[model samples]
Target: MESSSDTFGKDDSADAKLQESRVVTEEEWLQKWETNNIGFHNEQGHPLLKKYMDIFLDGRSGLKIFFPLCGKTIEMKWLADMGHQVVGVEISESALKDFFTEQKLSFSEEPIPGIPGKLLKSTTGNISLYCCSIFDFTSTITGKFDAIWDRGSLVAVNPCDRERLVTIAEIYALLMLRATLRPPFYVPDSEVKRLFGKSCDITCLEKVDGLAERPKKWGLDYFWEVLYMLVLK
Candidate 1:
């Protein structure tokens, strides 16, 4: 496991350049989903998620779990199967619909009161997916959550929007609770601390290289998966 100080040296100019180059837009994401280019979508519900769920969730049951920038990842359904209510906010309606279609789960779609997109819910009512931008998400609509599972949500956003996302998470935490952030790309521990250290306590940081298949599929030399647990203060 590499420490923050070791990962990020004194001069963070390289990190800044990296973030600048990696900035993405909502349209790009929509296009990715439309063309079925979502290499990030793991059907197995993320290896770390299954392995560390008990420890991260701390034996909580029937909790409301929030998934930000959620693609049609089966992880949401897996979480629902764990006796927890899964609430996911996604910008792409196609992705949301695909989730149900792929999983062969029946769901109903209804327009959100003031939000831009509609809400899709499983017939069993254990899973609810809000098809809207994360910016449009408000407490009035989704209410609060006990835990937030941010798999690739942070890394998917434009670098400029990262802080705004953090602000939203802070507000969500005020009413709800803690978060588990897993960025798809490389994000230094120092940067994570800089973003959430004040409002949340950094409980755990672990580095693992479990997704061996992703790097080659995505045309990357290596992919490091970092697990970060943030306990809201």
Candidate 2:
């Protein structure tokens, strides 16, 4: 199988090809941490998430969950405490290394075929970090997750890739049988219906307070915003 990383050459635009070519080789992506340039990384949990997590999750346990663009999120550990297995896909090895170090656990790594990915294993569950791109793993990963968590994935990426992101989210909803929330960006209901059809049900739509824009550091204009939660028929 061809590795997913091999599918898209480095430097491909995030909005290119809609599905096949958005993967880009971004050395600067990791700079957010190396230079401490992260404006979107929230130190505290999302307030809206805290208020409604139970309403959607209902104390569910052992559900497989996916967190795309997950960057050492403390929420993953929180989910683990509730007995859910969390799977995160991240591109930056430095961030991943820092996360595990902070967690104080040793992780085992292995390659995945037809994709440029290294599977990281912890006692809680296995996390597959794709070196290639998100789209490549879409077809490889099976058995839909109970929930998909997005803290900054959507908002962090350039807006032109919105359609592709929706396609991925739709596929995830079909496989997992549930959709939790994709935050920091607002995906329109019309677009959701257009992609998944009008039969799809929206579970929740709420806005949470964001802390990235305090005294306006890092040239950020942070504003807390609404996010989408949808379920497909």
* Top candidate by lDDT: 1
**Mind giving the per-residue lDDT tens digits that candidate 2 earns over 6-32?**
122233223223433344335667776
Could you tell me every candidate's TM-score relative to the true structure? 0.87, 0.72
Clashing pairs in 1: none
Q: Candidate 2 local accuracy as lDDT? A: 0.56
Model 1 lDDT, full chain set: 0.74
How much does each candidate deviate from the true structure in C-alpha RMSD?
A: 3.1, 9.5
**Candidate 1 lDDT, 89-180, residue by residue in tens:** 99999999999999999999899998688999999999999998898898888777788887777667776777998988887753222222
Worst 10 residues of 2 by lDDT: 1-10
Q: Which residue runs of candidate 1 sit more than 4 Å off their true CA positions?
A: 1-13, 174-185, 210-213
Instruction: Show where candidate 2 strays beyond 4 Å.
Output: 1-25, 126-132, 174-199, 209-215, 218-222
